[model samples]
Target chain A: MNKKYYRWLILILALLVLTFGAGIISLLSGEMDIPWHTLPDILVQKEGIQYSIVTQIRWPRIVLAFSVGGALSLTGAILQGIYRNPLVEPYTLGISGGAALGIALVVVLGLHLSMGSYMLPLAGFIGSIVTIFLVYTLSFRRGGININRMLLIGVMISFVASSMMMFLMAITSSENLHGIVFWMMGSLDEPNALLIDIMLYASLAGLFISYLFARPLNALRLGEEKARHLGIHSTITLRILFVVASLLTGICVAVTGIIGFVGLIIPHIVRLVIGSDYRILLISSFLGGSFFLIVSDIIARTVIAPNELPIGVITGLAGGLIFIVVLTRANVQSKIS
Target chain B: MAVYLNIQQLVCGYNLGFQLKGIDLKIEKGAFAGIIGPNGSGKSTLFKAISGDLNIQSGLIEMNNKKLSSFSLREKALKMAVVSQFNEVLDVTVEDYVLMGRMPYRRNFQFFETKEDLIIARKYMRLTNVYQYKDHLMTELSGGEQQLAAIARALTQEPELLLLDEPTAHLDISHQVQILNLIQHLNEEMGLTVLIIIHDLNMAGEYCNHLVMMNDGNIHQHGNPHEVLTYQNIETVYNTVVIVRENPVSGKPVVFPVSEKTFKKTTNTSS
Candidate 1:
């Protein structure tokens, strides 16, 4: 194999291993003290006394970490492809704001819905669809989408959404306000297997659709004009990717309430490690994102020990640092060239 | 020959605060047409209008007997490939960049490039003589090499009509000559209808099948190189006097600068 190919293979394997190790550590953690020996027994569904500790709390949370991390990173990767800008992430489109608003409205208003979790996520998904549709419609004309304009609209909407959340928080009771604010900050404190399963399934669908256009993303890196000459329908490709990725971001936001940076930082890191080929970038992004989130969640769980830091906080700080490093590296690369 | 492109009273320009005007012109198929005018003469603007990059303000643009507005964007793209002014791209490999020419050909859910796509990219790269640079980074290539690569990228489109807007702008003299020569070869050898907006009048005079000397958004004089490139026409269009002579080698009209006073010495220098 070529040297580049070998390096990419080694990096992917290492990341995969690292992520697996982190998941195991997460599965074994907390005060419940599930015996490590019976962990495998619990996994296979042959009962054990510690099954509740292993399955009820630890497993669900761990699964949540993986799905959220994977979904965010994959969304980030696909968004970068669609926008054709490495600096732009999933939230860069402003769909996350729509998701945030959906969650906040349900929580702050104290809607006595029977299935709040499902309703919140569904609201988020619909919000994303509407936001992306608005952005597309506003920016598109004469068969072209102006990316800078679209991104500007997204940023403005996010700011507006953030203020709306703050307003709701200011007016609500302190008890409910705390939960809403924390949810907006992003967390995995409340995990149910059904939510994980639903998100995992949704993520799988988004990723499969994204995978269907790996080569087109590669082509898109050259910009839409050239892509059109190559016989790609630029508008159709952009629309499909935006809608699908928004859906993924929506589900994630609805489930976790604005977990920042997973979709922002992971794809660029993966691209720098591997080459910019869309096939490899997309796959590695999913794995790398899953691994990063898993590790971040681990840090979130263990660092304070008795008190956990929000997963969003950990990811945001870490992702911000990584983004700076990437910026510098890109600067140096351009300088050298 | 087929009526490949016909622009009747075609007004092409941007809507900059006020209005953009249209001008009349008709272009036949298989012609090595050149649009030449001084800077700000709307030469590139006209090209943009015909290529569907800019919508017409008023006049009509037709291709193959159909109105330009009538053709779908993809259909227009399939028929015309434009090698626009230099593009700013970073870290893209030449092969991958060239393969972008195949994007319009993909089904919605296609996640991979087929072997046939690679073959087509290679063929165009080879034709433009930039095949060796296929794996080189776009930022790494020299100006002339990049320009050739850009042409190769357009060639990958395999369009019936090739439109280039100041394609040789950044190249050095030898490379500029090389690029122009390549375009000339593509025109004559393949019988492709070539429309280029070149600044160098000498190059335009040398290669064009039909020269459109546009001044103030209108063709001042357009016909054979011999008929259009006269001392009077040059004087009227550019407000400068020049010596017009036959290029001894190609027998084409060649314009030389009159640095010293030539009005009194015109008769003496004619021989």
Candidate 2:
């Protein structure tokens, strides 16, 4: 038992170190190569073109990457636990599609021009909230929320939302279409300090609240009925977890458009390495996701030098490849052992 | 003896139809009782009602003079633990799975299992003979071992009453005997109240001091094994011909199904 605890400690520490390394790389490698040693001085002095670039541009993006990535992965872990299926992620519930449809509608109607730039994320949030409410209410039965029913409803809603989004995209002008497509592809280049702060705090709070239910989540792995037998109010626990995860995913999608694979891939990788004990899985997936996105953001920034790729593109490519490799390797190792 | 569980006029079922009709039963404290019936006889429904899985439409279920409905899920868990017939095959290790029994005792904001919880879990693991498999994954264990692990987890709950639903259903004879013997030992040595649902009438008759026979959601008979396992009640409830005889070793009532040939020959001779 002590050894198992020690292993968790070491794995968490290793993930922390790796995340820190990724953050440093993200800071140093973007656009103009900022020297590693000058980082501390630039932070304290707070005055130069380098300082402006580091503080005004790169720092917020890094924090955004961390929170958005962590929040998505954390949401994925919670959703997977509730559904008891490894494939269930934030997107499976259609939150991303809802957000995308919201953004597309805002762009098509020229709401961002009339209302303000913030209208985009506001519409996105509103869209996701509506989707969540629909899914939650539609699937609720006389006794409680049937999980399988909810999954099916979520998938159906996602299809409808995506179809609506495509309809809007087809009718809109080329300029509006371009805006909608870019937002759908996703990026971390937000200039709003307030949004960044909200994302960071919300992600951390999501982690903290999710940690409180870690034991229940662990009990849930034995299946919902068994969890209730073990004294967990499965219905209440699942409802609260669903809200928490959906809100987190909603916030993430609103801010970043739709960063796809972090939510699906990070938790999968973390579970493989650290085991599925939610006590460790939650925190580990959060850190692993932050690390993955920070590294992916660096590649997005530097791979083309002057021309930057959408952060989502890098994440999808890197995350998908990594997941395939890890799964195949795990399959092989399990067969051998 | 004081009654541990009392059910009066219990009527409960799913939305399609009522599975358990008006049923009345009482089990004294520390008694090893078994409920036996054929499929769709409401044995499982009754068990679910008592375990708080199914809400009774109209009736009362009391445990130790307190209304079972009044107790919270956590409170019910504290008083009784159930080893369900089918548990999901999970990726968790045996030790971690067994430690989940301590969940009801976990205080709010408690992140990890307490030292005392670990000790209790270990004690039960040892008792159930799953100590050696503690580090092994639950999926790696045999059916009997998994059932033992489940029982160990239930034991770790330190519940006053232990309920099992056909625990030996899928096990081979040796494993069946092993599980029943352990249950009997727990009942005798620790004074635990056991209420089990068993398909095998002979095993129920041999192991249980008290037996309740059910037919169509109502109690067909309830008495000592000798009285409850009579040929008349067995044939009427199960719709089969069975001969009841006293076992030579334990002297408990044993049931043997009459073969078609023997039944025909006996009928012909009698006619």
Candidate 3:
């Protein structure tokens, strides 16, 4: 194989090994001290409380972290490509704000699960879809979408959604306010099997679809007009990416609340290491995101031990540090180059 | 040679009320053409219309006797390529940027670049002298090197027709000549028709066989470079006095704008 192919293979293999290592570490370090030796037996035998904790509660939580991380990073990479801006991420266009509003309203009305667990995700998905459509329509000029206009309008809408969510919070009973507030801050600690199931299929399908469009995404880096001259249908590609990214982001947010920075920081970190060809960036982002979030979740659990901190806070600190480092390194590299 | 691109009564502009009116032009196959005009003369606007990035109010553009609108975006791209006036410094490598030019020919779902694709990319990179910087980030290159990489990417399309908008606007003198020379070489050796918009009159006069000069959204002059690059034509269209001379080397028309200070000093001395 050529040097390029060799680099890709080595990077991927390294990520897989790190992800497995992180996964095992996550499985071992929870509140219940399940020894590393018991892991294989616990995984195989489904009976007893040890098996119950390992299989039912802990495994689902770990998978949720991985799936949610993977989904957010994939959408983040797609958003950055479509907008042709490094600062853009899944929520940069207000997908998370819409989902948060949807969940807040659901909580205020006590309509989270009168019917089933799917209702919450459905609500969040609808809110996200509506927000995307609104931003798209408003940004549509005579013939095409204006990305800057969409970005500004998205920020405006996010402000509106946040106020509405605050209003909903003001009217809610004090008893329910704590749960609502904590959820809004983001957490992967919820052991909801149904939410995990929802994220599994949607995130997988989103990754597959994103992989297929990687070629167009790469073309778009040259700017929209040039991408058009290179056979990419820019408007159609943008529209599809908008919908898919919003959906992935919406579902992930609905399940785990508004997890910040994983979407933004993972893709940038991956790009810094591997460069910005979306084909490699997309796959490596998923792997990197999974690893990063699993590690973050581990820190969230162990740093405070028995009490458990929100995964969002841990990611916020870690992501911020890494982002600062990347920016500084980029500054130095540009000066030298 | 047969007429390859024909634009007739091409009325188009960004705003509805402001438009290029009754513009008609034709370029023969394998011809090197240049469009030169003052700012806001609708030179770039005309390019947008021909490339199908802008909707024409009323008129038609034909390529190879087929209506330009008849081709799908992909079909249009397969037949023609454009190097737009892009200025952003992205983080992509030079090799990847060049490889993107093969997008029109690739199946989108196929993730891996074919062996043929790599060969084509490397060939164009070497041609543009950007192969040495293949692994460097795009922003790492100088403005001139980046411009060459952009041209190399456009050439990877292997198009029959190429449209460029002020491609050499940012390059230094030597790199400007190098890029224009490479473009001329492509046109002459490969039989590729080229339409370029240029701000430098001398370069336009030197490189183009035919020139189209615009003023107030109208084609003021369109003919051989020697006819269009005259002193009277430049003064009339540009509202500025210029001395037009012949270059002794290639015998092409050369233009020099008379600065206001020089004009005042000469008038004062004569009086």
**Model 1's CAPRI class?**
acceptable
The reply for model 3, stretches above 4 Å from the true place, is A112-122, A330-337, B264-271
Better of 1 and 3 by lDDT: 3
Per-residue lDDT for B231-255 in model 2, tens only?
9999999899999999999999999
Sorting all predicted structures by lDDT, with the top scorer first, yields 2, 3, 1
Where's the lowest-lDDT run of ten residues in candidate 3 chain A? A328-337
Interface DockQ of each model: 0.33, 0.65, 0.70
Docking class of 2: medium
Tens-digit lDDT track of model 3 for A1-337: 5577778888889988998899888888878888899888877876898888777777788898889999999899999888877788889888878887887788788887575676666777777877877787888766678888888998888888888888988989886677678877788866667778889888989999988788888888778877888888888888888889988988888788888898899988888787788878888898888899999998998887788898889889999998888778756466222
Looking at candidate 1, what is the lDDT of residue B201? 77
lDDT, model 1, position B259: 60
Cα RMSD, model 1: 4.2
Pairs that collide, model 3:
none
DockQ for candidate 2, please give it. Answer: 0.65
Q: Distance from true position, residue B169, model 1, in Å?
A: 0.9
